[model samples]
Target chain A: MTFIDMLGAAERQNHSMLCVGLDPEPARFPGRLAGDASKIYDFCAAIVDATADLVIAFKPQIAYFAAHRAEDQLERLMAHMRRVAPQVPVILDAKRGDIGSTAEQYAIEAFERYGADAVTLSPFMGFDSVAPYLKYHGKGSFLLCRTSNPGGDDLQNQRLASVDGQPLLYEHIARLAQGPWNLNGQLGLVVGATYPAEIERVRAVAPTLPLLIPGVGAQGGDAAATVRAGWRPGAPIIVNSSRAIIYASSGDDFADAARREALRTRDVLQAARADSLRVATP
Target chain B: MTFIDMLGAAERQNHSMLCVGLDPEPARFPGRLAGDASKIYDFCAAIVDATADLVIAFKPQIAYFAAHRAEDQLERLMAHMRRVAPQVPVILDAKRGDIGSTAEQYAIEAFERYGADAVTLSPFMGFDSVAPYLKYHGKGSFLLCRTSNPGGDDLQNQRLASVDGQPLLYEHIARLAQGPWNLNGQLGLVVGATYPAEIERVRAVAPTLPLLIPGVGAQGGDAAATVRAGWRPGAPIIVNSSRAIIYASSGDDFADAARREALRTRDVLQAARADSLRVATP
Candidate 1:
């Protein structure tokens, strides 16, 4: 199935929009699993086994694995994802941006080598930089629109001249993204949950585009406001929470705590969906 | 020595600002070195040995090696660079960008793992994304400004609104880079030789910032115009030429051909330096 269809299926089967971020920092991992690739793999596998049914997707930030010289850690992580949760999507949160040829190699690395169902991309290099990845009909590409960090407004919010003489940066991206290059409909936008107004504005421009909303839990962003600003009638949205869910407990029962946190977030997401449906019906 | 001092020494020692790019494509390799990692290493080592004293530095585009899953290729490539020309700096052409935590990991991978003197970075994720790398006091970070590709103008040329209410995307990056964050003075900018006017504008904004000029030969960029635009009076500048130098010949004498092309480019850069000195004196 295509990425969109797979997302729809995952949303229905799991009954949640929560995307668990599997960003395993070596410094923060349980002491028992520290300093060994095999032990880290086991820890990640246990978490996947416990929470496969509670969320729509899993996002493994590539840098966390890449930081250590774990040669085959990425491949092993993808294998664990496929074995435990075949229906749920695995998004490789690698914000890669390069020229056309290099971008093609990165696409192969994310899709063929690691088997990511979707990958995040940096859109600063222009549309052609991302066009090669979007050519993959079965995979999805999430463009960085507004990030979650404190310095995100540095350049992303810079006002430029739109074709119609308005605020340019994100609107330019929105206009181009909604235009000809999205023929496969596998495009998504990354709008940080911290900026509710920007999320609403982005939604108004590209209402049909799926959004990957980050920065919800530990980042102090309100989940209710995010769902209210970002939710579409029946469109796809994946609300990701990383530190709050994964590191809920550093003890041996960490996996259990992760599952509990994931369940709580799922319940909240389901209630938000119900409220969004009510508003749409009214 | 720091990256700035090394650049100054290379320019003075070689009497040239040319930086030969080592972008080795497997298909373009010599007959004996076809499709093998060891042979590729030998070929690159031979080229470095032949051309080390003729140019300012060597730039190896990371994507070419990454494309072929040649196990331990990057390690071998760095080993070859160290052995062939210990004095010449190696600039890794990997345009990586991400969050602060993730960027730190990449910095470790590039400087610690690969032993590169400098690495290219994309500034799309904002300042925090690059701050981790800049923390390495002795290493160099080249932020992408105006690229040489055809579609680069799409975003890089967009007129952004500044606090002074002027056109300001590249200008904003220049102004922000001048603050305390760049204390080590190891920061540089990557502006394409194809956009000489933009290069001049960027230089006018940040006069002391070193510049890495790519797109010289095969990309049809004017070498003289770029030298005129960016050459400071007896200061550091690296003019990179990849395909034109590396693939100068597809025969058994490929390494020799590469050395010859590098020599020619080096001569042109020396002449430009001479002209800059004359202009300064007048």
Candidate 2:
């Protein structure tokens, strides 16, 4: 199945918009893990087991893995995921962007080597940089439109005089989305939930495109507002929460706290979706 | 010694601004080394042995090695570099950028695990994102300011209304370099030699910061113009050439051709430096 279909099925099956971020920091990990690859794998597996019913997807930040030269750890993590919950779509958050040939290699690594259903990319390198990944036929690729970082406005909101005069950088990226670049219809945009106004604007421009929304819980982004901003009838939107859910409790009951957080996030998303449906009916 | 001091020493000793980029594409490699890691080791070792005298530094783009998950090849590549030319500085071209903790892990990998003299970074995550790498004290971290890619203008040139009411994204990054972020004073900027004007502009903004100028030869970036734009008296400016040198010949004499190209590039750079010196003295 295509990444979109997988995501839609997962969302419908789980009835959740929550995409748990598996950002395992060696320093912040509970003493039990203690920088051991096996222990790290165990921690992630337990969290996945607990929250699998409450999340549509899993987003693992590749940097956390690459930092450790933890190739073995990554393989183990993938094995654990495949065994425990094969249905949950894993979205690898790599933010990789490079020239065409190199980008092809990255695509292979993300899709074939790691078996990620989707991956995030930095669109700063232009459309061609992402062309190789998009060529994966069924795999999904999310381009960074508006990030959750404080300095996001430093460039994303710049008013550029393009053919469509006075357009922001994000707007330009959205406009490009309408071209042949979205060929396989697997293109998605990462419009941060932190920027609801911009999210609304991007939605208006590319209504059909799926959105991988980050920055909900610990990032102080409003989950309700983000759900409202990105809500489209039956469209896929993965609202990710990392630290708030995964590290809810660093103690022995960390997995339980994570489950509780995931459950709450899913409940809120379902409530928002119901409200949107009600308003549309009226 | 500081990264700047090491760069200065290398520049004087080699009498060249050339940084040979070891972007070994497995498919494009020559000889019996086809898809083999030992061949890559031999190829790189031969190039280093022949050209270490002509160039100040070697930049191995991580994507090349990373694409091939052949650990034996990577280990051999590193071992060859250590054994063949210990004096030449190796700048690992991995554009890594993550939050503080993850960034620290990357710093450890680049400086400790891989033993690279410097590593390139993508500064989109903001100043704090790269702070961990800068905290390495003596290791150099080159921030991506102006990339050689065509779509580089998408965000790097975006204008923003800061407290001062006028700040371009690249300029904002440059300004950040001047503040406390330079705690270790090991900050460097990556301004592609493709844009001479922007190179001059960035140089003017942060004169003291070393510039890792990529995009010469095959990328159509002019080395002489870049030297004119960024050359400072006794400052470190590594003009990198990857494909133009490494892939100079696909035949069995490929290593010799690589050496020849490296010599030619070094001579051109030395001439540019000499011209700049004369201009400065007069």
Candidate 3:
């Protein structure tokens, strides 16, 4: 199935918008897995097993695995995710950006090597950097719009001198992803959940495109506000939570605790979606 | 020594502004090595050994290795560079950009794990993303400013609305790299060799910062113009040529041919520097 089709199917099947971000920290792994980089797959796989039905998608942050020379484990984890929870789409949170042939190689890494359903990318290098990923027909890619980080303001919030209107940099990125850049209907924008107003603005601009909204749990974004601002009847919002869910407990019940947190967050998001729909209909 | 110190020492020792970019594609590998992903280390090591003394820096694009799942090979190649040519610094051309702990993980992947002297990063996420790399004390990073790709104009060339003269996106990045963002003097800018006038403009804004200028060889960026626009007395410009030098031959004499290509390119860049200096002085 195409990535968007998978997202919609997973959302309907799971009845959730929660995307559990698998940003595994070996040092933070509980009990026997603590400080063991080799068990990255085991830790992440357990979380995936516990929360597969609870999440609309699974997001794995590449740096967390690569940092500990655990790419093989990541490959294994990706395989496990596909085998166990094929219904849920996996977004590789790589944020990779380059040009031409090099960008092609990265596309191979994310799609062929890791077998990710979608990959997150940085939009700094513009269309050519992004164009390479679009060549992979059914796969999806998200451009970093208004990120949750405070430093995101250093560029994303700046006003652009466009003849039509002086739109903010993120707004320009949103419009591009919504219009000219979405050639294959595989484009999406990563709007951080921390900025609900910005999320609203992006939703207005890119009404139909899916939004990967991170920063909900530990990053302190209000789940209800994020859903309220970003959700629409046809549009989708994949709200991500990494640390707060994965590290819900420091003891041996880490996987169980993660499941509990995932369940809670997923329900909260579902409730928010229902409230948003009710208000919109009224 | 610090990364900048290694850069200066290598530039003086080699009398070259040329940086040999190690972007190994197995399909493009020479003779018996062709189509063998396992020989990535052997292929890259041969190139590094051949042109070690002809370069100011050795840039190994991470995507090329990671695409083939040859990151372990990259680790070995990094060790090989240190063993064979300790004077020439290695820049892991990752172009990684993230925030918070994820950024720290990437820093670890580049600095501690790979043992790279420097890394390339995308400045799209702003300061917090770039900040983690700076915490590595002596290590250096080049932020993508005006890239060589045609799509670079999509955003990098856009005018930013400010109280002062409306600077293009790239100029704002240059100013930031020159000023507040460059904590510990460990930052540089990646301005494409294809855009000589843009390089000159960047140099004008950030007079003393090091510039990693890629795009010379196969990409058809003019070497002399690149050197003339970017080269200045103490402010080093690393002119990179990857495919042309590395794939100079498809025969048994590939390494020797690579050395010849690297030597020829090095001399061309050195001559350009001398001509630029002569013009400046006259």
Candidate 4:
């Protein structure tokens, strides 16, 4: 199935919209999992097992595993996702962009090698960088729209000279996502939850596209406000919470804590969506 | 010494401006060196040993190594650069970007783990993402400005609403590199050789900063035009060629062929720079 259909099935099955980010820092992992490859595997494995039913997707930040040279651990995580929670998609948050040939290598690495259902991309190099990734019709690619960082405003928020109207640089990108740049129908945008107004702007342009909204947790984004601004009535929106859910605690109860946090966020997202629907109808 | 200083010393001594790209692929290696870790290591080792003195920098595109799960091979390439061509800096062409914390992990991956003297960065997420990589005082970060692809025009070339005289997106990024964004004076821009006009535009703005110009060989970039457009006398600019140089021949003489191709590109670049210098003089 296509990534959208896969996501739809999972959302309907679980009645949730939570995406748990697996950004495992060795220092932040529990004491038992420190300095051991097997332990790292077990930590992620248990977390996945504990929370598989509570969420729609799992985001594995590529840098966290790659920092420790634990690509194997990430591969194992992908394997576990397939074996246990095949319905829930795995989005690899790599944010990589490069020239076409090099991007082709990354495409194989992300999809063919690591088996990610979706991958986050940086749109700096423009369409050629994204083209190789888009060829995988079965998968999905989320381009950075308005990022959720203080420094993000530096470039992405620049006002572009009028084409049809005086839109910000990110708006131009959103239009492109809804335009020719999006060759396949599997394209989405990553509008950080910290900037709900920007999310609303993006939502208006790309009405039906899936949006991977991060920054709702540790980044200090108001979750309810973000959901209200980000949700499209029947759209597939995955709100990601990495640190808040995955590292909910560093003790032996880490897995259980992760499940509890994910469950809570899932419910909150559902409630916010319901409220937004009511407002729209009334 | 900074990456600029190292590259400058090499350029002045070698009288060459070519930067060889070491994007090794295992399947393309000589028949003898196949199906082993030693094959991947040997391919890069042989190429570097042959071309170390012919060029001022060696750019190992991280995806080429990471795709094959030969990150250790990449580590070996970095080590080999330090040991053999200590005067020549290695630019880790990862083109990585993310939010601050994730950027920190990537910074550690490139600078701390791989020990690269410089890295290529995607400017999509703006300052905070680039900030972590820039924290390495001794290292250099080459921000993507105008990439060498048809699809690059989709975003980087958009005319920004005049914050500073209606400059294009890439130009704004270059001006930012010269102004407040370049904290420690080690920032550079990647203006692809394919777009000589954009290269000239970036060079005109960031006069003294290094420009990592790719697309010189297989990407249909005019080497002479690029050298003329990109060269700033007494500036440390690098022109990169990957597939054309590294995979020049899949035969047993691959390393030798690569050296010959690199030496030729180096000489042509030198001739172009000298002509430009003569024009500027009298």
Candidate 5:
């Protein structure tokens, strides 16, 4: 299935918009799990077992896998997801950007090699750099529109004079949602939950595209505010919680704690969605 | 040694400013070599052996390795560079960017896991995103400035009103070379050779910083024009030619042909530098 279709089914079937970020650091794993090459896959496998029915997707950050020379563990994790839960897609958060030919190689790295249903990319070099990723017609490409970081304002917040009303760079990029940049119908933008108003702006620009919303939990973003500002009836905004959910406890019951955190996040999202529905009724 | 120090030593000893990009593709390789998983390593080993003395640095684009699921081959390639020619540094063209924690993982992947002397970065997420890679005090981080791609105008060419003269986005990033961005003194920028005038602009802004220039060989960028526009006395601006150098011949003599191509590129750069020196002698 196409990534968006799968994401829709997962969100509907699970009744959740929460995306569990499988970022397993060796230092923060459970006490039962040995901090070795296999720790990442084992910890993630247990967590997936505990919370697979509660999340719409699993966003695996590539850095943690490569940091410990645990790439074979990453391969095993993808295979586990495929074998155990095919409905929940895996969005590899690589955030890679390069030229045409090099970008094509990166696409193969994300999809053909690593088996990601979608991959996040940096759009610093513009359309041609991201074009190669879009060629995987079945896979989704999440461009970094307004990232959720303390230093995100360094360039993305710069106001461009050529644009009408002199919108910020992120807004200008969001406007491209209606342009030829999304020719393949598989393009999405990453609008961070930390800035709820910016999320609203991006939603206004491209209401049809899916939004991967990070910065909701540990980054101190208000979950209700994020849903009220960004969420809609049909738009699937996958809100992610990495540390607050996955590493909720370091004890023997880490997986159960993870499930509790994920369940709480899902309930928060559901409550917000219901409130939005109430306000929408005229 | 630091990236700049090693690059300077190699350039002086070899009397060349050429950087051989070892981006091996199985489909484009010579027929004599078997298309097994190790072909990338064997081909690159031969190419490196043939042209070790003809160039200053070796840049291995990570996409080629990751595309074929030959990351182990990449590890082998880095080992080969250390064993065969320790003087010439390897600049891994990864162009990765993310938040602080995720970026730290990528830094570990590039420097600790694969043993790259330097890795390319994208400045989309700002200083903090590029800061983790800088923590590796001995390693180099090349930020994406004016790339050699067709869609560079998408955002890199936008004029920001916040600047004094409404400079292009790439120019603002170039100005960072003079600020707190290079606190580690191991930073560089990737300015494509496609636009010779843009090369001059970057050199004008960051006179002391080294520039890794791509688009010279196969992307229709002129070698002499690039050198004439970018070369300085103490500053080393590396001119890269990947396909044009490595795939100079498709037959069994591919390594020898690659050497010839590297030698010719070095001569072209040398003549341009001489012309600039004679013109400035007055």
Candidate 6:
């Protein structure tokens, strides 16, 4: 099945818009597992097993694995996720950007090697960097639009002088992802949850594209505000919470704590969706 | 030693500005080694051994390694380059971009794990994303300013509405890299060899910063024009050629052929530097 189909299925099956981000820092692992890079797969698998039924998707940040030379472990984790949670989509949060042949290599790494349902990309290199990922007809690619950081204003907020009208850089990215760049109709935008106002602006421009909203947890983005701004009737918003969910506890009950946090955040987003629908109907 | 110090030393030691990119594609591997992903380290090590003394730097494209699950081989190659050509700097061409903690993880992945002298990054997320890498003191970071791809014009060429004056997106990046954002005085810019005029414009904006100019051979960038536009007495320009050098032959003498190609390209860049100097003197 296509990534969008998997996303919609997981969203309905689990009744969630929440996406748990697995950014495993060995130093941050719980108790016995702490500082053991070899246990990366073990630590991440527990979190996946605990929260698999509570999230619309799972995002595994590549750096976390590569930093510890645990890429082989990541391969095993990818297989574990596939076996355990076949219904949920997996977004390999790589944010890779390159051109032509190199870009194709990255596409192969993300889709073919990792078997990811979708992947994230940086739009700094433009169309050709993005086009290669679209070739994997069923997979989805989320372009970094308005990221969840103070530094995002440095380039993303700058106004672009266009013949038609002056639109901010992020706005132009939104329009492109929602229009011409959505070649396989599986394109998405990564709008940080910290910027609810900008999230609303992006939704206004794109309308239908799935929005992978990060920063709702440890980054101080309000989960309710994110859903209010991004959620539409048929549209999807995979609101991600990394540290807030995965690192919810430092004790042996870490996986349980993670599940608790995921469930809480998911309910909060669902409540906001209902409120958003009510306000829109009125 | 600082990355800048190493770069200067390598340029003088090799007496060349050419950077041989190790973008190994197994399907294109020579004869007996053809379609064998396991030979990534072997193929790249041969090229490195052949051209180590003829070039200023060595760039290993990480995607090419990761695509074939050859990251372990890449690690071995990194060690091999350090041992065989310790004078030359290695640029991990990852083009990674993210914010805060995740960016920090990527920084560790590139610097500590890979032991690279420098790494390429997309500056779309701005200062915070770039800042983590600078914390490594002497290590260098090259921000994607004006990439060497046709799709680059989509975003890099657009004029940005700024308070001082309107500048293209790439110009803004150049100004930032050359000025405030270049913390620790170790930041550089990646400008394509294909757009010689843009290279000149970027050089004018950031006179002292090193420019990693890709697109030379296989991508159709003119070496002479690239040097004329980017090279200066104090600043260095790393002219990169990947396929044209590494895959110079499909025979048993592949390494020898790679060395010949590297020698030819290195001399062309060296000749251009003299021409540029003579023209400037008159």
- Residues A90-149 of candidate 3 have per-residue lDDT tens digits of 999999999899999999999999999999999999999999999999999999999979
Overall local distance difference test of candidate 4: 0.85
User: Model 5, stretches more than 4 Å misplaced?
Assistant: none
Q: Return whichever of 3 and 4 wins on lDDT.
A: 3
Where's the lowest-lDDT run of ten residues in candidate 4 chain B?
A: B29-38
Taking chain A of model 6 alone, its TM-score versus the true chain A equals 0.99
- In model 1, the Cα lDDT at residue A163 comes to 47
lDDT per model, in order?
A: 0.80, 0.79, 0.94, 0.85, 0.88, 0.94
lDDT of 1 by residue, B170-205 (tens): 666766665544766788888888878888888887
DockQ of all predictions against the true structure, Cα-based: 0.62, 0.39, 0.90, 0.77, 0.88, 0.88
* Displacement of the residue A273 alpha carbon in candidate 5, Å: 0.7
Query: What are the per-model numbers of colliding residue pairs?
Result: 0, 0, 0, 1, 0, 0
RMSD of each: 2.1, 2.9, 0.9, 1.7, 1.2, 0.9
Of candidates 2 and 1, the better by TM-score: 1
Which pairs of residues have clashing backbones in candidate 2?
A: none
Off by over 4 Å in 3: none
Best by DockQ: 3
TM-score of chain B of 4: 0.96
Order by DockQ, highest first? 3, 6, 5, 4, 1, 2
Q: Which portions of model 1 show Cα errors greater than 4 Å?
A: B37-40, B179-181
lDDT of 1 by residue, A1-282 (tens): 988888889998989899998877767776577556556567777778888998888998877765665547667879989987999999999888887667887887788878899999888778778888988887999888888687687778778853466564776676666666576788888888988888888887778888999888887778877888888866678999988998888887889999999999889878887887888789
Q: Candidate 4: DockQ?
A: 0.77
Itemize residue pairs with steric clashes in candidate 3. Answer: none
Supply candidate 3's per-residue lDDT for A31: 88
